[model samples]
Target chain A: MEQAQADKNNSAIRPVLFCECLEKDGIVRRVAAALLGGYAFTWGFTALGTTCLVALGMGYAEAEVAMLLLAFLIFLIVFLWAFAAVRIDRVWKVLGGGAVLMTVMAWVMQHLLLH
Target chain B: MFNGFRIAMTWVHTWFGLVLGFVLMVCFFFGALSVFDREIDRWAIPETRFEPQPMPSFDRLLLPVLEQQLSPDEQEYAANMPKLHDAGKGPMTPRLELPVDEYWAYTTHRDPVLAAGGGFRVPHPKDPTLENHIHGRVTIDPRSGTVLRDDALKIGSDWFYPLHYKLQWEWKDLGYWIVGLAAFSMLAALVTGVIIHRKIFREFFTFRPWKQTQRSALDLHNMTGVVALPFHFFFSFTGLVIFASFFYFPLSHTLLKPLHDQHAVLEAQRAGLPYERAGVAVPMASVDAMVREAKRRWAARDMAGEVGFLTVTHVGDANSFVSIYRAGSDRVSLVGEGIHFKASTGEVQYEDPPRAAVSEINEFLTGLHLQHFEHWLLRWLYVLGGLLGAVCIATGFVFFVEKRKRQHAKMGGQGSRVVDALAVTTVTGMVIAAVGMLVANRLLPIDLPGKGDWEKWVFWAVWALTMAHAFWRSAPVAQGRLNPAWCEQCWALGVLAIAAVLLNWVTTGDHLIKTVFTDTYWAVAGVDLSLLGCALIAFWVGRKLMRPTTYEKNAVNRALALHE
Candidate 1:
């Protein structure tokens, strides 16, 4: 009874934890990053990223095919980076940066320049 | 050695591998079987392995067969539209489902051989003009004009081929997308795994077989992953590349609509037909004559000069075209050269020259990945690579469970238990289920309606039950001890594989003793011998797993004590 009372008293003084799951590295989030962040995001990213590369290579004759294959290889790097980032927030951030950059470039090339 | 960067990579590698390893194992195992898919098909359908006459004129044999199958009453071909089943032939109307209608779907073999159960694919009706999609198949005695055998069953190719890339799901290319995701995860795992394991080359030669469970499993995992690193990378990359068009075509349509349109324009320019269908009704000419003309042209160019596939469009219209392709066995490249003819006039409409350099390079890569050509040694190499991949994935699964199983059990290890059940199902359970499919094929009444469908149902049903059995038998959780379910299923695999071989011999009357020596169908003989070999291996592994264990009690107590 004395030991139980002492443990209860110890528990009362213990610090509270707000993000216990995140601190421990959330499994569900990690899985989401692997599937959604790594796969789903990389797919569209490759498309846009490669198209941007192709647009940039407009001066070169064989730009489309060469840039296209290179873009395929870049997709692997993007997938690894997504999964390797320490937190879910970081994965989203990296994906967002790529998405935004490609979208801007594609918009400019398709509408402003090509049209 | 395991610093921050390595730690992060390790986590990524482990999680990605765990998430998709089961899926990859299914793909790899089925892919290994598919390497010899035709051989297995020959073994499964014994009646088709007979010696066949030379490739007779298609009109002489097939015309009469089609006439009988589609009697005068049913000759209203253009009245109804064709439906396709993706089996590599034009679809049939409702009346075409008749037993006679089976001959409509016929495929010729690499050789002059043809059979009722194998060695044939579906062709279009008398017009022999259907869009490129494949539907059904039939094998016939080409000389007799009689229906020797006919069905849409692809016991070898269709059953196992789609499993590798599509997992047998036909949900609007959803299977491809799922596998693409798995393939993507695999690439990530491969990259991160190499980064974390800095001594990848050293691990290639390492194997600590005498060590405890955790050590050995990890060692095998590292060894297989590193040794077959090139294969895994190349295959994954090429697999993605092969389907890159599927994803990119849509993207191109969105981003570079003009280029996509220009591509179609160029293709039409080169094709000479422009895909126009004139409504002027006209009788289609003889495909046999077209095949002969294509063969002659190919011979003039010093090619192998045989037809692998024949496609026809606008069957009853004047604008119909007939395309003939060089047999896959003719060359190492997949996109073989072809000549298109006007179906109504039998005039050589256009001949596609050799593939351009870029297309040639792509075809070479795809050919290396697909291995439809007649090179036996390289095919075996592919099989070995596939098995190594299967081993790599299996060991990864084992290491995941073995490393943390004890600790996990302490926390009421629901996660680890679920993984264990899944592991057993995908690994050993898959083997037994595959064997059960063959056994069901042999035992089921051949004349039964929908025999092919029953074979597929049995395979899937057994697969599900084994998963259920693994969970049902192991759920009570006896701590650190190995699940006896593993041993039970291993025994089942061994028994079933061997029994499948025996059943083949008993039912077909062409046992190994005769097939190995007398018959030239090494494909049939090879499948039987391979099954026997698998049975021996399964039995050996079963014995090893059933051995006495010294770690059970400590494992149980420590895990149980975690909650207390």
Candidate 2:
């Protein structure tokens, strides 16, 4: 009976230890992704704002306003994406979408406005 | 009581530096370079004519010809160009005489009106539809509109201006704020470092190179930081102030502007203020006359050298004026008293001689920072001071990593890995980014669709790549030993520099030999050579560092023993 009890205790503790390891790893991954993602997103937002101003013939003041709005919009999108990526375990999808959207938007803005 | 305050300030100084030493080092290194930004730009963009030349009497040589060529309607339009100098009121823009295909560039004097009101100017088509003749540059012989050689001075200024701002962040107000914060942090670090050093005074005269690198680093750090403590503090603090508009104003806006109104107000402000055209039908005075007046004004001020700007204000109005400011003053280049003249009558209206005040203080600080005065001796001293600041920061960075490295090694696993990666990113990564962007500058076509802005993008892109690489590949210990990222970056720099030289030679048909001997040494050529120099330095450093070092072997052995 004692041997059986000991076996049950070990089984229960094993899952707890595994959970702890997962939690720590999850935290680290989340932090790293957020940092890197935030940085990339900031760049994308800035470029988008610049593009909007140039294309729209907006003045410097307007450009600044547009930049702020876009930055806020990007931050919201990123926050949501990160929440899903971290909380819901969709890291790859979030990172992939963020990268594509940022790069595409940046390139498109540059092309359309600059040209 | 003041002495007690002084004692306390000493303590404050010590702690501040220690806390922010590493970042300060970077700031100082970059700041030092920024001091010579114009010079660097001159060095970089070698082909652009940067220096001004005295024009022959335009009225005597080119005016009649231009008057004959210009249509009456075009002449009227040309008269709308802004005037040069003014009295206390404002400065004027120049009227372009386009008949000779030579633009009469006017000099503006120091006029209060120039700061407040419309400049005196006459507008014309900047582009004349003539290839290689569009510059509108003139020679002493007005008939010959020869293009002057690009001066070397402007390139240095161009390169160094951006360097001061730490081109890492997007070219926004925020980037400047970030730099300011970093500088403030450096100030903090400098203070803290002094506190941490128990033997600052004793160590001042002591530098033993044969001793441990750490000791030598510490000594150098203390010596530079301590000896130049006043300079470092003033510079860093003022730098913060200079960028205060970026940080303080924005934060204030955040607090003052309601969330919704901020965007609207900013937008409203972005719409540039309206400008009114001058309608008077009178002929303007000659630019040659203005130049002569400006020189006379400068002479009156006991100043020698050419005027920096000649300003004219209210071209057609009865109050229309011209102003001339002295340039190349040693102590305060920015603050000058100018002589203002009436545009219609060529009569002196008001005189503003230099006066000392808060604005003068500001100018003095800027003068100190810019070395506005052309005293080579003082300039060299400034350079030495700047280099010392760079050394202080570089050593601080090395020290930060070294300290962390010892601790990280004991911790083992990913903790050690992250630190190792950070070290590589901060030190080698920044250098790589700099060199990489430089290469991009030369390689990218000047008239490429987005080429004008590409240099900025290239810099940010390379930095981002390096940081990402550092973060990802750094976790594995063996990866640290390989330093693949570092090696890759070093190799990239070498390739980039080599490629730039080749590209320049191919495109310009002006290699080093032709540049130096045949076509006359160009300013852009200096940049290519500098790029080459950077590459050589990188290769040498990489080779030396990558080679097996006895010191590293011992360090490893020591680590193993400790683990045992």
TM-score of each: 0.81, 0.58
Best by lDDT: 1
Question: Candidate 2's residue-wise lDDT over B417-493, tens digit each?
Answer: 55445545655666566666656656766556645356666767887787788777655443324345556667666
The total number of steric clashes, by the backbone 3 Å criterion, in model 2 comes to 94
Question: Every model's DockQ, to 2 decimals?
Answer: 0.17, 0.02
Q: TM-scores for chain B, in order?
A: 0.84, 0.66
Error of 1 at A106 (Å): 4.1
Q: Relative to the unseen true structure, what is the C-alpha lDDT of residue B309 in candidate 2, on a scale of 0 to 100?
A: 46
Q: Residues A1-115, candidate 2, lDDT per residue (tens digit)? A: 7579857854542211222434555534543454356545654555555546646765433344345434433543453344234243565456556666865675566555434
Name the 10 consecutive residues with the lowest summed lDDT in model 1 chain B.
B98-107
